[model samples]
Target chain A: MTTGNPGPTSGPVRSEFADDAEMTELVQMFVDELPERISQLNEAWNSADCQRLEHIAHQLKGASAGYGFSVVGEAAAQLEESVRQAEDNLSAATRQFDELVDLCRRATM
Target chain B: MQQQEQQPVLLLIDDSPSIHRLLGFKLKNEGLDFLAAFSGDEGLELAKSNQPSLILLDLNMPIMDGFETLHALKDDPETIEIPVIVLSGTTKPEEKVKAFELGAMDFVCKPFDIHELRVRINSAIRISRLMRMLELRAQIDGLTGLWNRAHFNERMGTELEAAQRGESEIALALCDLDKFKNLNDTFGHPAGDAVLQGFAAVLNAELRSYDIACRYGGEEFAIILPDTNLEQARSVCERVRVKISERVWPNYPKLSATASFGLTHIGADGRTDASAFVDAADTALYAAKEGGRNQVKVYSELPEAGDGPAKLALAS
Candidate 1:
């Protein structure tokens, strides 16, 4: 869970509202924004903007679970924690950041 | 200051658009008027203008993070009393403690249970509303339902300060029921009470919406007119005077009441304390009483000292 790496048996992650007919459009909107969020995560990491990276991860951690993407939320939480505690060690935080981006890529409606 | 009951407003301050969208959808049926702000600066502005019942503040904003924003909110007189619930993505106990120290009413970690959040929000709004009601009750007069003398004193000082600061023009008027003692002795206490109540109603009806009318004491009242000059205030007081004189008590058909008013205006250059401001209006009121029982007298119209005999305008 701390590594934020998806297990081999884990399939494309669906929202908790995947089966909720009323939430179809909202859940789809969240899923549709995944690519943008993934790009944002990469931009923050590549630019070495640890503060921005932490903010984006923090937002995802708070928002993903409500959209029924608990896996992505967990990944985001792990990345946020690593960045917060990283201090001078940037390697570990970089690893968690990449793992979160992968989770966002695999998120589905 | 009794406010008409309306749907409570819930303001969410968060940098994340997704969080705003999600909460907007989830809390749509929670019987609240929802407002959203994407940054702390925007949130602070909205809080001052709207005075929302409850605030949901996110802790991880970019420039003005939750702690800084919380500190600012608690510091401002306008937004200090508002209850805030801090929402943080991290589950650190220290963050929770810090939020509470900053005057947050409650703290909810990320991935909060929707049911729990609803219950917490309801309880906070209920408690805040009750507190406000209690505060309002303390400042209101029970007999006439107008602001009590204590509230009037406080408001007068605030209005004077604002006027001196060049923010707005202000006027004050002191009103006394002419020959009130005669009415009380002749008609009895109960009848006197009815006239006071009737006078209060006339004041309420005649004054503009922003004008504040207060029960200064027995048989006397005070009015604070913000953003008004001498002519406007005199006109308003004249209307109230006429209304009081025309009012007829059904229980006592022969009963008639008239009130004398002293009006004073303060502009941006006016350098006066609350006492002096009040005294100016009181002097005008004395002139009104001396000239005639029913009339309006402006402070500026009083004769200069040692100039001549007091040349006061008598009511036609």
Candidate 2:
């Protein structure tokens, strides 16, 4: 059922979406820092530094969505929201963090 | 350095009008023609069309940002080799790291430091120019500004390789000055130097425009004649030999120098090694030396040329 809905699956659908060029730039920037960000995020998550993770995730949230990686942005937003609550559900948070990493890897690689 | 005749094209991709104006003025003296693009899309388009040697990409933009622009620039085959320097306002620690990963060769922060930015651009241009110059120098002989021995070897190899694969006639000749050392021994080294320069000039003048003459070493030269057989090479070498023999040494009465040449033509089953071709010419050179020191010899029959007493002349 291809609904002809242009989205991430279509791989950068440049619409009256004046955002394509902007998204391209953001994606390029994100991919450029991806390895470093991935490493930093992994470390922060592992060390249970929720505040730092929240800060990183907050930035990623805005940036990922800007580049049309909505799912990644959404996941980053969730992770940050959970971190803000100081929730002790480490396992659940870790799962979301891992998914975020996967989303980032997919967006880039 | 004084400005060169041709100004290399430099692509400046920045959305800031002020920055553009300032840089346009700043780099006016650099002798580079600037192609400006305010947005990534525009810049990429320009890059595709112009193929600028260097790109100045701004990181922050509205619809398309610098990072995305960088990725697109790196991905495309035509623009891949073109170096990019990120000129962005994003000063975050993570941002700098990302810029490098995304194939930004260098980065400049805005409110750009004029000196730092100029230095980076200058360095990029310098390095690129140096690389091109080194490549050219590698192909040339340092002393005479002619092709070097390695170039000669490579070219000869290619010619022979082509000949071996097809029905092409390739003629190779080696010419050595006869009794050149005696000139150096009689006159000072300066006189010997004069002779070498004079010899090269005369050789350059005598050979056909298509033929290549390279100084092999002290008092020795090599000429490669394509689509020429051993007989043609022999004749060509004879003309050059006669011209050189008749040349009166400057300030030295009764002093004339001659060159002994060995010519060989490669046909079917032609050998490709530099050593083999050289050896054939060398054998002919020895024959020239033996048959009274001022003629061309072709390597037709090995046994009949007969062993003549080999007189070794030191290279001048």
Candidate 3:
């Protein structure tokens, strides 16, 4: 799959800043913090806290693009949208959350 | 009170630390004093105290959100003129309209294109700086560089209101160059202008930093001394009088000028009217001019009945 696409067999997704000399350190810091964000997402999902899930997704959607992870940002946006409209489609939100988690796992420095 | 221009301050009110970090890094070289607030409430407080030139406010904050914060900032007389730019994660048309209607100067969607954001910030700051320059020009006397009469009237009302609230003692003084017309006739108007400019310099030098000096009209000037009593005001005005009498005019080496002052104290009984207070000082000023033209006279010490000269001792 392409870098931003959610595919089970996709290779590691390199940040857009991974090649930039100036942004290397910042990009590495963002990459280092990914595990904690993933855990937070997992905790919010397992607790079935829709508000907490949407808040995290919203933050990630805004922050990921700045860190050069457009794929993660786009996934987060999709998850945020699904959760926002989850009154009748809880399954859709669940599917988006799972896709976002997979994208985060594949993200690289 | 003239303030020296400094680096423009940009306050960022956002809940996310990542946005602050990103913008802080991106805008590092933009010659801005950057301030960050994690929530809208904190941003409002900073805006009030620091008076930032521009504000970048996030619309998605919790509790006191961006809309509420913007409303509060615009509501306050102190922060109302500061320009605010709204930042949002989503570009909802209705939200954009709401933000603009609530007085936002611009709206940017996150994550920002750093270049575009920089241009927008520069343009906003430039416009604000130009506007402030224009405001200052409007209130300043063109010749003497002291505050103009209109600004003095406005400040007098404000100071009087503060005093009426029992906040502090305020003293007003009306100073006039002794025999200004004679000096103009003797050495020419240029020399008179030079003397007026020279007196303003002395006023600037003699008054405390908190004191405000204004060119009332012609060779007449007014001073507003906040948190000063009658004795304190007398000492300050005495110094101005002494300094002016001692100054030597450069081109016209033979010209020597002196000024007379009339002082009045207020807020002891919470008097609020501006004109009446001015009239009292004017009465004292008339006493100074009549009592041989080179002295400081207090309004309270003036004779109770007629327009006779005040019996207060001259400054030694």
Candidate 4:
């Protein structure tokens, strides 16, 4: 029995941008910036700063694909939407938020 | 020499600044001018002022949201014609249907693919430019290449209202080519057509770009000169008349056409409405015919508008 490997969305999901030196530069910047952004995301989540978390997620969604991290962008987008929908229900929103944060961390790793 | 290509402007209305930064970074080098609005209200304001070639509206936004903004835009006379592509995170069919029903040209799901976004933006702009060309063709006179009567009337009403608000002087002139019927009857309709074409060329050459030059009817033209006084309008009319008098008709080389002009000025303080304004101009034109033709006549001295002895039927 053959099992398909889970894809590396943060890795080389697309080789189209691999050869693009400018895009590679952006990818490097994104990799360098990820830890700081993730820290900010965690801080926002811990403090119940829904607005800040949504904002960071929104930014990540827009920028990740440009830097060759399609999965990261998708995860960010999901987080952003969830935050928007979960404005009045913080307890129910916690699981979705935590799942996306783990997904982002794993993608970067 | 390289001609500078006009880049299409895309108005993006989304609440997220991250989306703005992302789209901007992706599209900045792609030969497009990106306009960003953080909210639907801000987007609507930008749409009204900038008149972007296309709009990429986010469905989920704060306050005004995408659907509400789209409705407002479609209802507005200035922006109703602008093409909007809905950008939403949800892939729900009902959402797409609602967007379409609200006059969205296309729907895009986020996070956006740069290539897909480019394609959709280009398609929307192309459709909008084509629609504008179609509207212009409908409003233009095929024969004289001037504005048609319907367009003229609409513009006249708009200009009159604008002038009223600005308290500015404006002039309207009604001109008729002398003995046009006789030329058509004696020298054939082709000769008459050539003269009409020649006259139109002269009018175009003599009038300002902002002037509303229209083929009001057969052998008759109406011109609206905004921010022009009686004397200024007369100078323009005289110049046009002289140019028409000197132009050699294409088929009938020896024949030259002379047009009689009737002009009226709406004073800075005066209150003549649209109907009265046009009537005064037509009456002034009748007076020009009465004054042995080929001359400019002011409506201030002419009999009451629409009650002049010289019927437009016998003006030639």
Candidate 5:
């Protein structure tokens, strides 16, 4: 299971570790879950609800990092940041949120 | 739903899109199908329906993490035989230890190589197949595909014990081919093989599946009739003897043969020894051969030949 270069928005979360071929293919199974999770995160952001957004972001962060998509995890972290600081810079937070979602999509791909 | 009707399923629970995509692509060609669940609840539901052969679970998730899922899986009898492998981003020693303690067969850290993952999955499947095969081999005879001597011993003991306990009677019959050696010598090795095969088919068709027929040796056969007495045993032996005597060798049409049978019954006294039952039957068999090549002899009225030991003998 060769994990190629991480996209610009995502860092190499999975590349640091070396696993046998069996483990590698197992990691590759994550491809199926990405789209639905990304949609859920998007829904969480659309509502501008900090709690649900943070919940979704945290999930993506933990899972994407495990699957070697540090970029997606980083994007999730930023999205979580916007939710945590929701009381300030509402518009700016929304823009940052959009960028984070895009980052997640690119990172996973 | 019928328990017997359930189809075995394999569940793949992971949160990464790329992982699922690649796996679906790789596994699609292998003739196995899998259901994918990104969350624990979804995985649990799929497991309930699919009853998978194995589970590949991811540790990190939004709600109901892999830890909880593994517990639920192991705790459920329906899913217990389904082996699980943890696919997680947590490379921590404690995490791996915890996964195994929770009954995961293996743990693989994230960004796994496809080749290695395939090998592990295949290995797990192979192990399960081997275990099932071993269970089957225990009941099957290796040589003639008929029940073996050991099976006969077990069935006889059980039947006799059951009969003794219930105040019932049981019958035993032993059949030895008459002049079998001469047939082997005249027909050569291949002809001898054909005889055995042909005899087995005839015996199989003549007897019910519940009737135990064992290849006692080179050309001998044994049958144990539960709930049967000496009269019934003689009747069954006659039917079988008639079938065997009537068979015409396809290649050598003129060739004809017969088998001598020994019949004995365990009386209501329930004191008949297991070995004695066989001994009585064998003695009757010798009588059948001595009296006539094609005949069924009962042990109660017959005298035992001075056949050395009291044990059942294979008269060479």
Candidate 6:
């Protein structure tokens, strides 16, 4: 599924806002929202909620890099692409989805 | 003019919490109020209400996506002027085109550079503010800095409709500078223009911010006072007249000019036509002039006017 690299899943994702106090609040918000979003991501994938999966993946891909989660953005981009195209490769979709979620779980501030 | 002082508000419409967080922080230094909406529906709702200066929209949202939201915003008269910048993660050129075609002002890629985004926002806000300033200039009187006659007419229609809906009282006053022709002939056209400008300043000073003042014609003006009764409007017009009479013209120090006002209220009866309402005010103004100049009279007070000329003079 992944061509060797599964993307970063440890340590802090560096962003320009890393030094900002206001950004710390946003980091807190992201942390607070993590469990719920991760659960929804899992539920959507398991039930073949294709639209939900695509939406989550799209949001993750679009926002993760901005939040300094480059690895999560990379994985989510792959998942979003696969989900949107209705990719026949179920294993690849599963791999990318898992990787994206995994990186999100591992994300620090 | 007061609206000029507010920081331009930026609405961030993105389903992604991270995007909201990032954009909020990234653009925080730009002196803009940031409004966040997680869904396209919420975004549109906020856009319609707050009418933010600029919107940073994410292209791939749920239910109503970025394109749909952009279309909705562009379609509405209230929100149409608000500029929108699309956020796209995929770097898809076609999607970017669609966003542009649908009325997006610009785009921010997934891995956005904060400095670049700041520059884009600043540029967009600068352009928007410039455009807004031009639009407002078109509506303002060149000499007085008040709403011009055309803009006043346009605003009166809407205000009348609103007054009717709310069943609230709205007063219209038609004011004319007494013996303006004599003053002009005595002093000259430039002095006449100076008096007009000075009288406008008095009106501006005496009137509330929400009150609409306009130069209806040469040496004549109009005022629209929403949520004001006849007595209140009369007092205001009287104050303006007194202020004008008391003011010493810088160019013509000894020259003192007076203004006559015709006041009328759109009461609970719902007389909603702007033409008739204005005409009624004009008629009352004519009565003020005939009742010996420099007096404020309500249209309803005209019938009993001649009976109490002494009282009117004393009041004046």
Per-residue alpha-carbon lDDT of candidate 2 for residues A22-43, written as tens digits (9 for 90 to 100): 3354345555676777888989
Report the C-alpha lDDT of model 5 over B160-196, residue by residue, as the tens digit. 7888788776788898888888987887767776777
List pairs with backbone clashes in candidate 1: A16-A68
Positional deviation of residue B74's Cα in model 5 after best superposition, in angstroms: 10
Among these predictions, the greatest TM-score belongs to: 3
Report the C-alpha displacement of residue B131, candidate 2, in angstroms: 4.2
Error of 6 at B290 (Å): 5.0
Please give the ranking of all candidate structures by DockQ, highest first, separated by commas.
Answer: 1, 3, 6, 4, 5, 2
Interface RMSD (C-alpha) of each candidate? 0.8, 12.3, 1.0, 3.1, 5.9, 1.6
Q: Per-residue CA lDDT of candidate 4, range B243-268, in tens?
A: 88888665676776899999887677
Cα lDDT tens digits, model 3, B14-129, are 99887888888889999899999999889989999999999999998778889999999989999988989899889899999999999998999987788988999998888888
TM-score of 1: 0.80
What is candidate 3's CAPRI-style docking category based on DockQ? Answer: medium
**Each candidate's lDDT (Cα)?**
0.86, 0.72, 0.87, 0.79, 0.72, 0.81
Taking the tens digit of each residue's C-alpha lDDT, what string does model 1 give over B1-316? Answer: 6569999999999998888888888888989999899999999999999999999999989999999999999999999999999998878899999999999999998887777888999999999999989999998988899999999999999888877686577889999999999999988888899999999999888999999999999989999998997789989999999999999899988889999998877664556677877877888889999998799988777874123122211110
TM-score of 6: 0.77
lDDT of 4 at A2: 10
Docking class of 4: acceptable
Residue-level error in angstroms, candidate 3, position B108: 0.7
Candidate 6: Cα lDDT at A81: 84
TM-scores for candidates 1 onward, in order: 0.80, 0.54, 0.88, 0.80, 0.55, 0.77
Put down candidate 4 lDDT per residue, A19-42, tens digits, no spaces. 776566555555666677779988
lDDT of 6 by residue, B1-316 (tens): 6575788899998777677767777777789998989899999999999989999988777678788899999999999999998877768788888888988889888768778889999999999889989999998889877788889889888888898788888889999999999998999998999998998889879998889999988888999999887778888998998898899987788799999999877664455477767777887899899989988988767775444322322132
Report the CA-based lDDT of candidate 2 relative to the real structure: 0.72
Please give me the DockQ of candidate 4 compared with the native complex.
Answer: 0.37
Alpha-carbon deviation at A104 in model 4, angstroms: 3.1
Q: What is the DockQ of candidate 5?
A: 0.14
